[model samples]
Target: MRAAILQSSTGIDPLLSARNMVEAVERAAGEGADMLFTPEMSNLLDRDKARAAGSIVAEADDVVLAATREAAAKAGLWVHIGSLAVKADRGTAPYANRGFVIDDTGDIRARYDKIHLFDVDLPTGESWRESNSYVPGDRVVAVDTPWGRLGLSVCYDLRFPDLYFALSDAGATMLAIPAAFTVPTGRAHWHVLQRARAIESAAFVIAAAQVGHHADGRDTFGHSLVIDPWGDVLLDMGEETGLGYAEIDPAKIDEARGRIPVLAHRRALGAVEVAR
Candidate 1:
């Protein structure tokens, strides 16, 4: 299967971003791509809390989601909407950062809310408190697709290896990590963490990323990448807003696992206490 990863800057306007994604979807479909992957917050990226709270709506009401679904149906291909900020229930944290997997018929196959919230104070004087606006999800999600069994995770989830291990154990052959990563952190840890996950799990890693400066005054590290199970970088979109394509060969997964067999070699570790 051929997959297309889109690295683009998303602003606060949902309709505009959706239009851009639709165009990209058409292009990818024309190029014979079976699946299209987008970055997190593909709908909107607003720095102002009040504006974001007021603008973001439920998935059903979101123009971006609706538009993307239509595009997928028209193209007759699968689309992994990396993540969208959607309004939550009345009592929840007002919103949820959610990922959606849409099939060829434009029906939603799976939905996963982001488990980890990015709450940090950066050395560059940039701070984000995602918990203030979005509720964290508890379940780890993986879905079956024509390409392979896919594991789902978002930006901050990339920092946690145990989650990937669990997914790999659950029979995920490929992992999707859609992100809107801050520039500083992305520069420091992005490639290393992604390669580590692929190498350890012997699974294909597809990471679609947000890039460049947005209207909200936030800059992201844009290096959307697709890595094979053997830790080979297939495609990397450097600091640019565009679409990149890569082939997904199931044979590679089998070959990588057969050579390493790391997952089969496991041992239980008893609890250890530290001596003063």
Candidate 2:
């Protein structure tokens, strides 16, 4: 399957972001791509809680999602919108970090709210308390597409192996890890983590990422990558934000799994025995 990865420098403005996404859809379609993938916080990425409120809206009312869906339908290209900040039930949390799978017909195939919220204080004097603003989701989402079973996940979720394992066990041949990573972490762990996830799951890993400086007063590590099941990097759009294309052959998943048979050998651990 032909795939297009969009590495964008998302800002605090949702309208500009929506326009960019629509243009990306059109360009990807014109380029003969079968599908288009975007980075996390495709609509709005702001560190400030109060300042972001103006653009954040319910999924039903989001202009970006609506525009992307319409663009996808018009282009006849499937789109994996990395993630968008949307209004959630106030009782639970003020918002949700959500991802979407829009089919060529402009229909929502699946929705995955980012379960693992990033709540940490980095050594760079940057602190994020995602849980303070967005409620974590409890569902694992995967959907059937022209490219095969696609598992959905957002940025911080890449660190967890259990999620990918479940997705692979659920017959997912491809994993989407869309992220807006900090410069420090991106420079250190991005490539290795992405490769490791693909290697273990024996599935293709597609990562579209936020790149460079943004209007939100933050810097992002911008090496968007695509890894094969064998852990080989196919396309790495480093720093530059635009449309990057890659070709995926579904047969590779079986090839890698056949070589390792890791999934078949997977076993649940009963207990940890204390050592003397």
Candidate 3:
């Protein structure tokens, strides 16, 4: 299976972003990518709380989601939109930071809302409280694909290893992380952490990320990568605002699992007594 990772500059213009993503998908398809992915907040990213509040909408009625589904169908590939802010619940103000998996037929196969909220103050004086604007998802989402079982996650979720372990326990072979990671955090922990997740879970890690500065004056570290089961980056989309592609070999999954039987050597940690 071939994969395409897309990176884009941030903008208030959701329509333009959608168009750019469609074009990128087309290009990746031309390169024979079976799966295509976009970075977090691929539709829009506005740091202004008031602006993001007013601009974000609910559901596929949002033009960007509609265009993405159409693009996925046209390309006949698995299209993963990292995360988009959409309306949730009734008449509520906060939106859902959701990720979607669209199949070749353009049907939404699975959806995962971001579970880990980025609510922290960086040492650089940059503070983010995502929970202030979005509602967290309560469920863990995994989907079965032609390639293998896939686990879905978004930005900030990368820091939580238990989630990946849960998905791996459920037979996930590939993990998707669509993110708009801050430059500070990405620089410090991005690649190493991503590789660690792949190595620990023995699963393929495909992270598509936002790159460059946004209209909101926020800059994201763009280094979209696809790592194999052995924790090797198959494709890296440095700092460029474009797309990258890689092939997925399911046999690699078997080979890695066979070499180190970490998944099989499981002991009942649940029965362990905690030391007071």
Candidate 4:
């Protein structure tokens, strides 16, 4: 399967970002890609919640989602908009960082809200309290695609191996871990974590990321990557903001799983007893 990874520099303006994404959809379709993957917060990325509130809306009312769906149908290309800030169905938190899988016909195939909210005070002096604005999702989503059963996840979710385990346990052959990571963390752990996820799951891992400075005055680490099941990097779009394509062979999934056989050997262990 030909996958197009869009490493984007998101802006505070949702409408402008939506237009840019539409153009990218056309480009991906023209390049003959089967699927297009975008970075997290593709619609808007503003650090200031007060200013961003005007742009964030319900999933049905979001112009970015609407535009991307229309573009997907027009181009006859599958699209995965990494995550859009949308109004949550039920929560004290006003919004949800949600990902979408849109089919070639402009139909939404699946929706996955970010479950693991990033609540940390980083050493680099960048503190993120995602739970403040967005509520966590209860469901784990695995969807069917032309390529294979694809698992859906968002930015901070990459750090949780148990999520990947659940996805693979659910019979996912490939994983989409789109992110908008901070620069300090990305420089230190991005590549290693992505490779580890692929190696552990024995599945293809595609991560499209946000890069460089944004309209909101924050910086992001931008190395959008694609890894095969054997932990080999297939495509790594370094720093620059643009589109990167990679070919995913379903056969590789079988080959890696057959060699490692870890998935088969996996056993459910009981809670550990404290040595103390």
Candidate 5:
């Protein structure tokens, strides 16, 4: 199947932000993509800690979801939203950093709350405390589609290689790493991390990401990419407001695994060690 990965930018206006997403998806659909994936926080790129916390809401009533659902139905394609700020429960907070898979029929097949929270201080003096605003998910999730079993994950989860291995062991053929990676980290680690996962797990890796500056003056390192099981870059969206496409063959997963046999050759280490 053909897939499209969107490298999107944050806009000054929320509605316009949503429009950019719709237009990108539409363009991808017009190009005959069976599936289309958008980056994290596809709606607005508000980086102000206070505003992002207050503004991002996870709800079925979210405009971006509604529009994407409509677009998916109209385009007759499966649309995977990398991540969106969703309002979780009312009377408490605004939302969660969530992602969804909408089938061609406009039905939501799967939903995943970002399991790993981004909380850190960068050398750039940019501090992000994702835990302050959103609740983290407690489970690993995968969903079945016409293509194959798809593993779902968001940005910070990239650091945990074990998660990718687990997904592949569970029969996943493709993994999604949707992110709004900070420019520094993205430039330094994004491609290598993605390539490593594909190499280690023998699964196709699809990463859709944000590019350029957002509403709150935060910039994302955007190089949305699709890598094959053999660590080959099938398609790369290098710093642009566009989409990247690649044809995925699920059978390649078996081929890669059969050749490398990395999963079967593993020696297990017992227990986690405490750092003193």
Candidate 6:
């Protein structure tokens, strides 16, 4: 299967981002791509809590989601809309960082709300409290598609290996980690962590990233990467706002697992007593 990864910077406006995404979808379709993957916060990227809360709408009312679904149908390709900041139900939740899988027919096949909220205080004086506005999802999602079984995850979830292991155990052959990572952490841990996940899971890792500076004065590390099951980098769109294409072979999963067999070599850990 051939896939196109979109690496772009999203501003505070969802409408403009939708337009840009549509163009990229068209280009990917022209290049004969079977699917297109985008980055986290593909709709909008604003740090201001009030502005974000006011600007974001429910999934049904989001223009970016509607436009992308139309584009996916028109292009006849699956579209993985990385993640969108959505206003959740009034009483149950404040907001949701949601990811959508749109099929070639413009139908939503799967929806995964990001489970891990980024609550960190970086040494660079950058801090985020994602839990303040968005509620965490308690489920791990893996869905079947024409290409293969896919595992869904978002930005900060990359730091958690257990989630990936659970998805792989659930028969996921490909993992999608769409992110809008900060420059400092992205530069430090992005590639290593992504490659590690691919190696450990023995699955193809497709990470479409948000790159460059946004209208909200936030800088993101943009190196959208596609890694094979064997931990080889297939395509890397470095720090640029564009589309990167890669060919995925499902057979690679079996080959990698056969060589390593780590997934099958599981054993329960026994209790350990303190040395004191």
Best by TM-score: 4
Query: On residues 1-276, what C-alpha lDDT tens digit does candidate 2 reach at each position?
Result: 899999999999888998999999999999999999999999998987789998899999999999999999999999999999999854478899999999999999999999898999999999989998999989999999977999999999999999999999899999999999999999899999999999999999999999999997899998999999999999999999899999999889889999999889988788999999
Residue runs of model 2 more than 4 Å from their true location after superposition: none
Most accurate candidate by lDDT: 4
Arranged by TM-score with the best first, the candidates are: 4, 2, 1, 6, 3, 5
What is the TM-score of each predicted model, taking all chains together? 0.97, 0.98, 0.95, 0.99, 0.93, 0.96
Could you tell me which 10 consecutive residues in candidate 5 have the lowest summed lDDT?
86-95
For model 5, the local distance difference test gives 0.85
Candidates' C-alpha lDDT:
0.93, 0.94, 0.87, 0.95, 0.85, 0.93
Write candidate 1's Cα lDDT for 70-165 as tens digits. 999999989999999999754368899999999988999999999999999999999899998889988899999998899999999999988999
**Worst window of 10 by summed lDDT in candidate 1:** 261-270
**Which is the better candidate, 3 or 6, if ranked by lDDT?**
6
Per-residue lDDT over 129-155 for candidate 3, one digit per residue giving the tens place of the 0 to 100 score: 988778888889999988999999998
Better of 3 and 4 by TM-score: 4
Candidate 6 Cα outliers beyond 4 Å, as residue runs: 90-93, 268-276
The per-prediction CA RMSD against the true structure, in angstroms, equals 1.2, 1.0, 1.6, 0.8, 2.4, 1.4
* Superposition error at 144 for model 2 (Å): 0.8
Off by over 4 Å in 1: 268-270
Model 6 per-residue lDDT tens digits across residues 55-101: 79989999999999999999998999999999876435688999999
What lDDT is reached at residue 273 by model 1?
84
Task: Give the per-residue lDDT digits (tens) of candidate 4, residues 36-60.
Answer: 9999999999988899999999999
**What total of clashing residue pairs does each candidate reach?**
0, 0, 2, 0, 6, 0
Q: After TM-score superposition, what is the CA distance of residue 35 in candidate 3 from its true location, in Å?
A: 1.2
